[model samples]
Target: LLGTVLLGARRFRGGRNPQPRRAPPSPTYRERGDTTESFPLDFTAVEENMDNFMKQVKNLAQSLYPCSAQKLDYDMKLHFLENSSVTCNDGTPAGYYMKESLGSRRWLIFLEGGWYCFNKENCDSRYETMRRLMSSSKWPQTKTGTGILSPLPEENPHWWNAHMVFIPYCSSDVWSGASAKTDQSGYAFMGSLIIQEVVKDLLTKGLDKAKVLLLAGSSAGGTGVLLNVDPVADLLERRGHTTVQVRGLADSGWFLDNKQYRSTDCHDTVSCAPTDAIRRGIKYWGGVVPERCRLAHLGEEWNCFFGYRVFPSIKSPVFVVQWLFDEAQLTVDNIHLTGQPVQEGQWRYIQNLGIELRNTLKDVPAMFAPACLSHEIITRNYWIDVQVKGTSLPRALYCWDRSFYDNSRNNKAPPKGCPVHLIDSCPWPHCNPTCPTIRDQFTGQEMNVIQFLMHMGFDVQKMAQQQGMDPSKLLGMLSSGS
Candidate 1:
């Protein structure tokens, strides 16, 4: 019965409903120490458990939806960029998913993140990675968890029923470039064009009617939100949604200009010195610099690309979410980009990044700077539970939203002396256990899986049977891990 229903579901590609393709295999649990996990199951055992659980899911799905006539829409519907020529890094069609439901006329548009690449070689490598990691074929038809994109109201109280749009990143330009194709490289640097087209499409699809708009993204997408939020808001206002309350939330995209860590040449450590990449990106993509940003920075137009520099210039109230010791800086972009050793100096550099972030965004309406070492926090399983200063991250965000909207409606200044939600787990490098970490091995995979299921509105005891684990043991593990 499940097979019949699955076969009957319309599969969309390039606006055509094609024959159903074989569902992709479940993703393997590639362990990252920075990802907060609550249960420590053996890696192999987790894989076996996942396989068993998936089988049960299939069976349960079959029983729940016995009629093949009941069509199951893909969690994210694919809509290619309106322009015929623009495509992703791999030359595949670029697109976003609009998951509409009955809720507020408010909108929560999330920009998906993948890091950027500047030079031709780096761009080519990024293109290949996009093909592997972001090919439309790789996405799951059905999203099953909670947090940022969750459809369930219990999990995402504020945003569950809003017009939720997820824009995929494929341009390797952080959605800020619009370069003409050059003979030197075959890649299309049309990220700016992609953003323009996507926004236009959304405007036509009732985004002009949005009472509230929260433009948010993670990593590169987070940077994209900062770069494009004003333009997007302007587009809506011009379309007669002048009263629409638009705000931005940049998650883990509070990138800093760590010139202290980069080499003199500036070519190798472009990630650390993001302005260099931004300069190349602007020229390559034919992107426009925000006029206010240009005037604010004056001679330093490239500084507009870095968040710390740009945050002060944004007129819209944006909530900044970041970690004090972002694990990505420690492991991926910073040291990895510059070939710097993980010494005391590197630690100081990370701390300084946080300091600059705080100083730059001190005046922003809302900020969530946790002392965790993790990178992206909003979409992770831990977002619902992870707390700093006795307030869960989500709760803090909700409160911020309430305050922001209330202030906007009432025409009142934000209450003075209100503490910024800066959650520091202090003691230098050794993070507080309660703070999220991907570095610990004893972290439990089982707990992660259980929490994920709970977020999806599943019964843990029933799901545990599939994994050949005792439900009580799973609960205990989760308790201990927490």
Candidate 2:
């Protein structure tokens, strides 16, 4: 059955978009604090006009260049967890998709990203929107495989031919929780068990024979990859796959140790600090901290949940892909210091985050930290185009992967320090201009309103009037480089 699936999948040829031969000029932004803050005369009229203008721009752009990636079809089949006992958050069976193709005896397992839930209210809210993800019945038979999961060798040269496993996020534990707790609210946490069962089943299906393995995840899933990569590799090695060259890649999972953000309320009205969420998750899920991390931190086991603290103890070679000014940190995480006109302190905090991140991964094999405002990168077009010092992110990653897989001990190590591909400028200059005008695949609306406002020369006062919002509130949102 596996051979037949691979043979059939080989017929589907995926094409890659040509890389931009020449780099575009670095984007320019107006000097901050240059313009005066003044409200528009008519708030309602300005709002309507701006909305209509944005709509027209989005429509025109969509007509000219629809997202070509979304149009392609790939032979990806969703398979429910074979063990009847393994289940997801609503007691539904857990599931994953496998796209088998002819290539090396390698495997690329991608853990899907969705933030975790701590309590029943959080779980219930997540369930409402993620029903399709939580249940196998609603799994899409065919998915457009793009980004790291792209089936085309031209696009994803690393593991295009290797078996691809797409594990859906349903357990809400970052795949690290073990003990199941049933409260009066009937919430169950079984992420760690689900991962164990999934790995066992994959080994039976040929993962045991894998010569190369890349365990990767984005957002919360990225956290999962970091926490579980060493254990997963150990599991495979114990199963007689010791020769497998195992590596891990975390996309946008470089969560910081900014506990201060927890005090501030997030856009969702929840605690903004990820540490707070981690603490709750640990309590409810009965998750175990990595032994090395626990030993290092002694009594502060919770510190292990932060990527900065965890990276030092990670034994395997891992690559971290993140943005210096991550959108999630600014918006969803609510790390702002002042309400309006972005105080100097807030900017300092963002810069400190970058410095801390660089210091944390100083010894890692590779890192791609672009100075951009966006969150995720591996799954977007930016993965190919975003450049630093004349080297595109994909090219840098390719070079690093080559060095990582090199078996020639005689060859000198690529470099002792982390091969960081980072952008020098602040995120405002690197923000993708097309983001504001482009229509979102899910929302079918302009994806970035702040970018649009900035591009169109709209000031904070005008923006506040147009949206019927306070100027201070708008300024705080703008401070994040939204």
Candidate 3:
């Protein structure tokens, strides 16, 4: 209702977009098909949507980085061009495939990484390090094969051979400026479109909606995950009350979605927000720099959405495989839950899995692989998967970890570099040798947070819903007009 009521039928007022709602609809894979790409921006806010809280989040993100960032001239910006290629490979007209197998396994709709639509945006050192982190934190080169994931290749017995689709966040035609407004929600449009295409094709091909997996890389794609997952769940649940859980959510050095550092947002929290994560992200992801240098492109500097408040509800099981040393985008704030840092990567990974199982047992199975991973190390995990066993499960927390340094966030080395070559290794074989199998520079042997998840089952959503939990439930945040 927030995005709906605020954005009604007016022209984009500019500045930050209000919430977001249905434009009038002409309205598919069934989910994105239902989404219409006609809406305006709303610069009409005395305060951000969440008001005080949004200010706090943005300030927190901004304070983490201290260098003077380049301010947007605003005159140099671009919008949806009448002819910009916003339609090329919109992620539609594609089929889902297993990254390593085929024949009849679970299917996944994956997206590629490329944080900025403009190749020029990669100039930032932090952005570059984030790219390196992606090599480990997301689909590996050995696995995805030059960006095109091999759907259901007949190689492994456990290969989840099923229909899968890969959606690229920025269309080949979208160019750079097509979405410099409203927090890049336009990218969400592309993601939704791809989801629509994949769904229609899947249904037409006889695949069950409940069996679909939604995956994205980096921030824009991750935002797409937020936009698509819940809607996909709604569609699948409509078809089969017992929907299958989405298996893996490959997030790599993702820090700018939902909530990011911004002006007028993190006013007070700026002084107290945790700096360790930012420092660490700067250390490991910035490649000798800090997050500010990386995110300098964002003129608004608002934590529009954070992992704590953005992860969509999973109809099926889910997996979150992050790195132990990634430092691209650091923060203790949980952007996925919409606003719950307490439920971040491992925490939310656990909480969400419980929620999924509570919703369905066999249909949704949770799994995880820390891969001794980090925000930037995701792409490497795919290569590490060669040593990782079992299919990617839905358990919230699973696979890899080590806290060599007590308070690992700070006092850590810079986000210098990573083993970016791992992405090419096909389904890195599962072999969790006790010592750093890949001769990893980092070390920690904490695997399988299943028991912890089972234990959290007692609280999970109920606890999250509690008034004084972690973020100290807003109580009225979700049910307010202003």
Candidate 1 structure quality by residue, lDDT tens digits, 365-481:
578776655678777766766666666666666666656555646846644433446555342322333665332234434324334324324455754695589989856655454
Clashes in each model (backbone N, CA, C under 3 Å)? 10, 0, 107
TM-score of 2: 0.70
Best by lDDT: 2
Report the lDDT tens digits of candidate 2 across residue range 166-206: 88887777777775446664555667667667778888787
Candidate 3 at 11: error in angstroms? Answer: 71
What TM-score against the true fold does each predicted structure earn? 0.69, 0.70, 0.36
Point out the higher-scoring one by TM-score: 1 or 2. Answer: 2
lDDT per prediction?
A: 0.62, 0.63, 0.31
Rank candidates by lDDT, best first. 2, 1, 3
TM-score of 3: 0.36
Runs in model 3 deviating more than 4 A are 1-105, 117-157, 171-189, 209-223, 237-248, 253-305, 312-316, 330-482
Candidate 2: list runs displaced more than 4 Å: 1-73, 181-185, 259-262, 265-270, 335-352, 407-409, 413-482
lDDT of 1: 0.62
Candidate 3 C-alpha lDDT tens digits along 1-482: 34433443123223233334334433324466445332322211221222222233223323332221123111111112122322322212222232322233345565554433222222233234443311122322222422213221112112123344444333321111222112322121233443555555455444563333445444334534533455565566676734555443545422332233322322122211333222322222211111232254243212212232233333333333333222333233322222222323445443333232223222222223333323332233243233233333211121211111212446343222211111111111111221123312233334232222222232334444654554324223222310
Q: In model 3, what lDDT does residue 14 have?
A: 32
Clash pairs (backbone) in predicted model 1: 33-438, 33-439, 34-438, 35-438, 39-444, 39-445, 40-444, 178-285, 179-284, 179-285
